[model samples]
Target: MQNLQAKGLSALVAISILFAGTGCQSNSASATPPESSKTLDTAPATAAPAELPIISERAPTPMGEESVRGAPADPSAGTALAQLETIAIKGRAPKTGYDRDVFGQGWKDLDRNGCDARNDILNRDLTNTVHKPGTHRCVVASGVLADPFTATTIHFVRGNATSTAVQIDHVVPLSDAWQKGAQQLVPEQREAFGNDPLNLLATDGPTNGAKSDGDAATWLPPNKSFRCEYVAIQTAVKAKYGLWMTQAEHDAIQRILTSSCPDQPVPTDEGGVAVPIAAEPAPVPETVQDTPTAPVPGPVSGPDVVYKNCTAVRSAGVAPIRVGDPGWDTKFDRDGDGVGCE
Candidate 1:
């Protein structure tokens, strides 16, 4: 009987030990966090912002545009568009005309005012344009200016090294203004057109040349981000100068400003000639598609449009590029790479 009791006691102890072991196993599993939680704890952190944009003197920007949040509708176009019609383009669009030297014009100042309009503009735009050593008037230390031509910065150094990299851009290209009725301006108004500080800026040379005689209808900035503001400023300048726009050009500028920055107030001639957004037929969103270039006759029919060759390309409608001429080089061979149809 005593031995039976001892066996019973041994069995009880075994059962207790088994229960304790099971309890420990369950506790161990419970102590482990969830698999999902473990994953979250091991995840990596987020990234940082990029460096500031670089500023070059005359070269094209290697750094591209960043997306900008859109703005609201500009409200200055209505009256101004009407005003443009009332205010005729003063200059004549010549079938034949004189070169730059021929404007038997005003101010009668050869140096264009003892101080050229360019130096004056640099003084206005630059933070601190250093003057000539002796003259105390010429820009000797024009700092890096935001060149509107390429939408890049151009730093102008003084005295010794003059940068043709910089140019005085006529806010309204001389030719465009002429076509829009600048020829009718009285000598005084014409002089103002030629010399207005408001109408000129120190810009990148190549881009200035690229802009050449283009109007809103014909061309716009390559940098997509700056287009709206460009159009706005152009609108204001034309409005200020009493320049008229063709139906298409008017529509195009309106479309760009309205679509890109519906929020940015249409710049006004207010506060001294803000470019107003024109309220027109309709607005179109800007796209990367090839802008319809002024009509080019393709052998009267083939993909080949535009008569190419350096001089022809640079001087669009200004010179001798009549149809059926062999001199027509349409490859748009800007760099003169032997390949045509580029």
Candidate 2:
């Protein structure tokens, strides 16, 4: 337990280093300084550390208080936002919800550093990442994945290089992020949300995909064992950005903590890594010229829904769901995860 605790702390520190790299609030615009940028000012002249420590247990940070870094309150109320959007993609939300293109064509590689955050995290997480010389982007090979998911240290061989094995999961998925106030961000901050090193971690790709865009309330790691840590991580991210969760989302998290460690703390986002905490109350912007609306689709239904309570769904399956079936409107398709049977 002590060793795990140490590793957790070390990991949190490692996350801090990453966030510290971009300096919190990675805005593309230079209107004001970002939290992470300030660290840049204070970090010694030496190069950044090769690696940093991690932490465990998210201590629910008190509301309205200054964190050690003096992070400011969510500024600008973010830029004006249109109808909020959510990802309807398959699999789960990528560990690091970043896409240079999402914020517009070229922000991820800012310094033209070929090794973008994705590759950087891969290089750090994988056993032997075959990288492009100076930039580190061109990942020709990936090393074994060595990290603990729950009590198990996940070990992957070189042959199992599927990203599902070495994914960069956002501590907080982007869709859940949008719901939690990410929609308020100025365009630049939204782009940073996709790539900021602070919110990402090399995690199980498939599980990451499965989590998709659901929030802590709707989904969790397949490994039910890690629920506490996952919720703690989610809490940290939401708290860090001063994002607010729907009452349902908050209730979902409370359920998990009660089911797991009822006394867990809210954790910290000092870095992207998630930590556990005793217990506490529950808890991005981006801009761009008006791109065509993403076409708000209707809510999901029938076979497309993944109900939190599968039994409840199965019981109602006798009538079954069919396309355009009038009452098909109701049924287990409530949240619409698309796999009601499962």
Candidate 3:
């Protein structure tokens, strides 16, 4: 009985040892997951890179090259750049008495290529063009426009509403021109400035409207690729028209041209034909009075009143005549102080 009890105790001890081994194996398995899964959990995550803007089909032309439409190339790239350097930098003049009529009837056929300026531009710039029937190509019917300002592809059809989709832009706006020395120009020169193709562009209408009369300092095309070209065009126009730039405008333009378009060109050549001036009618000679009327003049006489100098007027007892007085002449009023003498 003692031998049997000792055997049973040994069996019980073996079973306990087996149970202990099984527990250790289970703990080991629980502590370690699969190596593949461990690597996946610990590995660093990578984020996707941002997408870049897509380049457009309407890439800007280089400084030396011509833009869409019959826009002329610079006379010489170096010459164009030199002209830009020559522009006078000055503060803008007040926009007093500035009107569209001051420039001339809008969009005259100054070039008179048998087509109006608007149609000429559309014909020159628009691709896959369809002209209006019975109008001798004076009107654009439909076309595709790859606008440089926003890099937008526009399908244009001529209509009251649709025609506004594309507009002819004055690269240098007339109002901007008015403030930049255009006020000093004669009527004909102002007209030339307005209608010059080198100063014009066909662009998206909204972009043009947004850029209304804004100089380089105020506005630039949104298309990164076109900004350089836009600056070049503005520089060329200002230089060609003998207009000056504000200090801020000059600096901004300089940065753009020097940084991106170092080889920028100017359109110094007049792209359009001379506007015709009607000859003045010959002056009709005043009918000579057969009988000379007795001199009824008072205070101022005919030949003596026309004093060549202030000294002559002073000598004639008309020392200081107000601006509205008969003896007050601009020649004598050097200072324009409303009084002829001193």
Q: What total of clashing residue pairs does each candidate reach?
A: 25, 61, 0
Residue 25 in candidate 2 has what lDDT? 44
Question: Rank by TM-score, descending?
Answer: 3, 1, 2
What tens digits encode model 1's per-residue C-alpha lDDT throughout 1-342?
999999999999999999999999899878876788766777675567778776333221112211111223345555333333443322234423323322223112222334444455555455435565575454345466766557686777643124545666666676566555555554445555666545666666567657766777677878678776666666656667666655666777767756666544444431122333433422222222224445433333345645545334334442322223344453332212121221
Weakest ten-residue segment in model 3 by summed lDDT: 284-293
Q: Give the per-residue lDDT digits (tens) of candidate 2, residues 1-342.
A: 999999999999999899877865465446566689877887678875677556322222222122222133233322111001111122222223332234333225332345455544554445443443453233424455544243334443223223334456776766556544555555555666666545666676556555655676567666676676566656655555556655556667777766667655443334232222314433223323222224333444555654343333333432223224323433433212221121
TM-score of 3: 0.59
Task: Output the better candidate (1/3) by TM-score.
Answer: 3
Estimate the TM-score for candidate 1. Answer: 0.50
User: What's the lDDT for residue 66 in model 1?
Assistant: 18
Q: For each candidate, C-alpha RMSD in Å?
A: 14.1, 27.7, 19.0
Regions of model 3 farther than 4 Å from truth: 1-80, 267-270, 273-342
Off by over 4 Å in 2: 1-114, 128-140, 147-161, 262-342
Steric clash pairs (candidate 3): none
Per-model C-alpha lDDT, please?
A: 0.51, 0.46, 0.67
